[model samples]
Target: MKQGIHPDYHEVVFLDSATGYKFLSGSTKTSSETIEWEDGKTYPLIRVEISCDSHPFYTGKQKFTQADGRVDRFNKKYGFTK
Candidate 1:
């Protein structure tokens, strides 16, 4: 291990704005904002758009798309051989 060459890893709170979920984890990321967590201590707060709590995949509701259909449509329009 090297000394004085690694980023500081500290406990921080990641807040999901969509679901109002907060999770505490160690990260090297920094932020100017802070918030009080459930432990009654203040930690750096980072707001994110998507998290596992609100993500469709984790919730078992992922959207399905037909990739082959779209490719067939493109081929028909451009006369490309498959």
Candidate 2:
């Protein structure tokens, strides 16, 4: 496409704080923080709260919502007329 008008795409590391998992992938995101990977190379590091490693859905540990209980609580507190 257009030259000199697009963001630079480079290899970056995404670190998951919860699981301490690091993934190397290409992204347009830039950061001043850097870290030495297991391969003895330094790359831009991005700290993330959740990733596939720690995500509930991906790990199959997702919590189920109590829909009926929440509805009852809301009706009792607000006196919902219905």
Candidate 3:
């Protein structure tokens, strides 16, 4: 435990830029912006481009390529039919 050597860790609101989604989380990062959270308290605001709410993976909007077996790939590559 050291004194005066650690950055201030506090709760801040992370804003998803694309979706305008907000969430509260603790971080050492600081910001000039502030936001009123659901708890009726004001905290520093941090903007982020991506979050679980807007991300393709978490939102189930991600596109998955068709999985082809080795044999299928080889056959397709060599123009094999039947």
TM-score per candidate, chains pooled: 0.74, 0.75, 0.72
Clashing pairs in 1: none
Please report, in order, the local distance difference test score of every candidate based on alpha carbons.
Answer: 0.93, 0.93, 0.92
Model 1 segments beyond 4 Å from truth?
65-82
Q: Which parts of model 2 are misplaced by more than 4 Å?
A: 65-82
Query: What clash pairs does model 3 have?
Result: none
Ordered by lDDT, highest first, the candidates read 2, 1, 3
Highest TM-score model number: 2
- Model 3, 1-79: lDDT tens digits are 8999999999999999999999999999999999999999999999999999999989999755445577688899999
lDDT of 2 by residue, 36-68 (tens): 988999999999999999999899997667887
What 10-residue stretch in candidate 2 is worst by lDDT?
62-71
- Ten consecutive residues with minimal summed lDDT in candidate 1? 61-70
lDDT (C-alpha) at residue 47 in model 1: 94
In model 1, what is the error at residue 58, expressed in angstroms?
0.4
